[model samples]
Target chain A: MQGRTRNIYLIPYMLWIVLFVVAPIALIMYYSMFNIDGAWSLENYRRFFTPVYLSMTLRSFWYAILITGFALLIAYPTAYLLTKTEHKQLWLMLIILPSWINLLLKVYAFIGILGFYGPINSFLRIIGIGSRQILFTGFSFIFVAVYIFIPYMILPVFNALEELNPSLVDAARDLGASPWATFRRVIFPLTVSGVKAGCRAVFIPALSLFMITRLIAGNRVITLGTAIEQHFLVTQDWGMGSTIAVFLIIAMGLTMIMTENGKLVK
Target chain B: MKKVMQMFITVVIAALGLMYLTFVLNSQQGYSGGNTLTVYNWGDYIDPELITKFQQETGIKIIYQTFDSNEAMLTKIAQGGTSFDVAIPSDYAISKMKEQGLLIPLDHCKIPNLKYIDPRFLDLPFDENNEYSAPYFWGTLGIIYNPEILEGMEFTSWNDLWDERLRNEILLYDSAREVIGMGLNSLHYSLNDTDIDHLMEAKRKLDALSPNIKAIVGDEVKMLLANEEAAIGVVWSGDASEIIGANDKLDYVIPDEGTNIWFDNIVIPAGAKNVEGAHLFINFMLDPENAAQNTEYVGYSTPNMKALEYLPEEITGDVRFYPGSDITDKFELYENLGKKMTAYYNELFLEFKMHRK
Candidate 1:
């Protein structure tokens, strides 16, 4: 009777997954097989393997890596420091508050902050460095992305640190391990799951970022997401868009596998 | 276990009921009553008061929707999900829709105000004999510059934009067609040139002008130019008018080398449920006084020649926005470059953008 009730409870979740997740993915896969003309063909897949797409994929991966690397670098220390603070939860909330604001609003804010007559340029001008073209560059794109993603990176790592028992660190220190060695040998490995989760959270979304590439990068940077959007919306070629999406999905799966905790640690 | 089961069942019932309610509400929203007309247009293209006046005058409810791009509007209509009574799409998009049979033929007998429109706008290549579309507004893609900043430099031809003095002082519109068209026009090639070599040469030439290219941007092009962030911007004539109005120091010019002249037209989609209502709205908009009002508010060139009488002498007299046929004759309307060629142009443009970095 208990088993039957548990199965009954699972029904709604299964339905939700099938309808929203599984079905859409299946539809995309089905669409990927067809060409723009609606004929059944592997033309889109063939095109995906070309140098144009391959190079774009590489560029997108490179940008995603840069964004994730910067985000993790900033977030890890912030998260670690927060764990030592008296009002850590409040600080964490403060970090998350900016994210609650609409993403487009935040992006537009960066536009003003990075504009020629914006504060940064004015500061530079006063300091004798002179104003420079700061907005719509790779640097601005990565900066805004890192800023937007820092909170996501921090939350999981913060949670991991919070969940950590202090005695484990004390035990390591008592054994004559240096602070770096204790962290490297013990605390980090234990919290490795959180780091993986945080990276997964930031990296996956970073790969498919389109709007930032447009508004912040001024279309100078084209990620895989932008190409997918261009194909689907501008060209009205859903097949090509779906084919790229399929590859993105595969890439995401590979990332998950590579970041899987037991496999990486072991 | 029994209590938990009871609570779970109650929650499921409540969720199902909420979903059903939302579904019904959504379906009701799309329900076309006899007196309702749904209009899909570019954001802020029409004055709100005009829609209110239109609704009051005809006793017809108006459901107005706006799309940011022609492609986005086309995709929504092409999907056959929503039944928009009227849509305002640009020249090339009209051709694409006409070819796809997504557009409904306009009934001229109902829209008597069509007589007010200039004959020059009629019987064009996109919709010959005004079959599927009617001219709403038309403008040329041109250069808008701060003459104060540019000083002795005159931007007469497209080549002048490449002057070394203008380095990092030019903003190009972030549209593939206009930017590519500028390059093609400089070389005296057709903007609709299908030859891959000509298209490639255009990209190559544009690449060399990167020193002058400060940034490629969209609607914000107007804001940046008006604030003197850039000395010159390649923009639409209508946008130039708005920018020039914002900052009197700014001036607009249609290059002597020729440029793309685009038209935004109102057309009924194939799935329109209230066809008659759509006609009434189109006719109402085309009325000389209404067209003049829209022209004043939208800051776009009105195609209604009769409406010119109602407009201010300063507006109607401006040769930049309303040029004589001698200059307009050199302008080309963007034709529907077939799917493959359109994609090729987009790809080449993307490559040019990527090359900038």
Candidate 2:
């Protein structure tokens, strides 16, 4: 009777999940198997295996990995610092502030800060490198992606770090485990779940981020997101777009599974 | 506990009252065709006043929305989830939309004021008889340059982008078709060329120009040019006008390689509930005064002949907006390349990314 009541309370949330998540995903799969003109075909998937598509898929994965690595490097410390802070509440608010701004707005703000004629460029020019443009480079794209996903990475790792018992560290020190050695083995291994969660959060979104990439990277940077968007929007090739989307989902899913397995091993 | 219960009841009553007020307002406005009408159009492309006027005229409240690209608009409409009564899509998009059966043919008689449209725009190749779309606005893509920076160099053709001197000094439209098509045109091939060799050559040309590009930009071209961040930008003539209005040093040129002549048209989607209201609004916009005012505010050319007549001589005579016959002849209107070719172009565009890496 208690189980039945709990399930009934979950009905609204389950309905929401069905409507927003399951429906779109199912539609993507369904559309992927068929051409837009209403004929069933495997041609979309076949085309996706072409060199061009494979190369794009590779690039997206590579970029996402790069962003995740950078995010982890930056976020772990920020999370550690926040966890160590006396005013934990205030520190949490500071880390959460950037996430409060819309993702696109954050990206656009980054562009204004980093573009060729942006403040950084203006300062660079003042120092003597005249007329060098930084607007459309690969660096800017990665920079923006890292900035956007850092919060996602930080929050999860922060949660894990915050939950750590002070006694564990005290015990380590009593046993004469140096600070670096203690952190390397104890703190990190224990925070693996948070790190895994943070990686999933950042990597998945980064791999499929077309809009920010398009805006900051000057539409010159192509990712799986742009490919899907192009197929669906510009070409009206829903099949190809959906196929690309499914491919991305599968790729991300496989990576996540691998990450989880890796965590288990550790 | 009693005070808390009173507060809760008072809050619920207020919420109910708000809902009732909204229902009454919607009914009074006569826009009660449905709960919402999701209009997908270019961001910042329309005059908000026009939307306000449309609502005021017919009690039809508009839930205006925007898309950054035609493709974005098409994607949402194709899914057929959200209900949209009307959409203003560019010429090429209208052709593709009609081909996909996503649009319903306009009842010309219902849009009575469509007669005020310029004859030149009416019988255009995209929608020969204006069957599916009514011209909303028209413009050509060209160079909007800052003379202070571009000082000695003449900006006449698309070839200028490839000039080693101008390398990393020019800005191009971020759209794939615009970038590739103009690159193809610079090489003297048809912008719609489907031949792999032709596309490869266009890609090579684009690659050569890419190293010199400051940025491949969209909406910000106006601001970039105005701020003198970009020496020259490939943009619509209307955008050039806005930039020039803001900064007198900005001058526009219809590149000698010709340009893309784009027309945005109003089309009623196939399953519109507010078909009558849509037609009424379309006709109302066709009025010369309204049309001219829209042209003035939006900085795009009007297809309304009466509106053209009302435009000041300076605007109508502006060569960028109304280019010479020779320059106009070089430009081409984009056509619906069908699905396969669009896919091919998208692939080629992706290829550029791979090459960059």
Worst 10 residues of 1 chain B by lDDT: B26-35
lDDT of 1 at B124: 96
Complex DockQ, candidate 2? 0.34
* Separate clash counts for every candidate: 0, 3
lDDT of 1 by residue, A1-266 (tens): 88998997898899999999999999999999988778999999999888778988999999999999999999989999999999988989999999999999999888889988899999999999999989878899999999999999999889988888899999999999999999999999888888989999999999999988877887778889988888887777788899999999999999998998373332
Best by TM-score: 1
Top lDDT hit: 1
Report clash pairs, candidate 1: none
Interface RMSD of each: 2.4, 4.1
For candidate 2, state the interface root-mean-square deviation in angstroms to 1 decimal: 4.1
- How does candidate 2 fare on TM-score? 0.85
Docking class of 2: acceptable
Candidate 1, residue B140: how far the Cα is off, in Å? 1.1
